[model samples]
Target: MEAVVSLDARGQILLPKEVREKAGLRPGDKLAVITHVHGEEVAYIMLIPARKLAESLRQFLGPLLRELLGPEESEGQGGAGPG
Candidate 1:
């Protein structure tokens, strides 16, 4: 889905109704703005739901965290519980 939006005087862009509906966005939903820089300018910008962003990060990091912390600690056993 592609949309061309304008930044209003307040630096705010209103999402097109179709785009919002396609993305399942609702009033007051939080979106994370991501930008790609090309030298000194922004090449492009993307918006993703904040909830999805955290889930993506957790899915990507969970394995690495588990490896670094070991299975016991990763699974919340707290490693220092019993002697």
Candidate 2:
């Protein structure tokens, strides 16, 4: 699917409703933009669902924290909580 979206003066692009619905994107959903550059210019951009990125990051980094701090400390109860 292709969408021709325009950026406003504030640099925000409104995603067409059809596009959003097709992608299963809803209000408050977070997206991550990845830019591919060739030399001096950006060649293309890709949008990734942020939750997907977080899950991927957690899979890679979560174990390292457990190894560094030990299992008990890795548990939330032994770690810092929101103040």
Candidate 3:
């Protein structure tokens, strides 16, 4: 979706409601702004939610942690013996 927004006096721009909804963004959601040169004369920007990104990382890291820590660490930490 494409949206046109104007910057306020403090140089803040609000994302349009439709655009926000389509992107699954909500109030107080954190975003990462990235800028790049689209062409020789044009620049492009994107916003991504930090929480969503972190969630993705956690999903990917789960198996790696299990492999590194073993089954004992997976159950719990510092126990006298297995029940």
The numbered model that scores best in lDDT is 1
Model 1 Cα lDDT, one tens digit per residue, 1-83: 47788899999999999999999999999999999999999998989999999888877877787779987786683322233
Candidate 1 RMSD to the real structure: 4.9
lDDT of 2 at 34: 100
Order the candidates by lDDT, highest first.
1, 2, 3
lDDT of 2 by residue, 19-73 (tens): 8898889999999999999999999988888988888877787778778887677
Pitting candidate 2 against candidate 3, the one with the higher TM-score is 2
The lDDT for every candidate, in the order shown, is 0.84, 0.82, 0.74
Clashing pairs in 1: none
Lowest lDDT 10-residue stretch of candidate 2: 74-83
Task: Indicate whether candidate 1 or candidate 3 has the larger lDDT.
Answer: 1
**Which candidate achieves the best TM-score against the true structure?**
1
Candidate 2 similarity to native, TM-score: 0.64
- Give me the displacement of residue 24 in model 3, in angstroms: 2.7
Clashes of each: 0, 0, 0
Which regions in candidate 3 have their CA more than 4 angstroms from the true location?
6-9, 34-44, 74-83
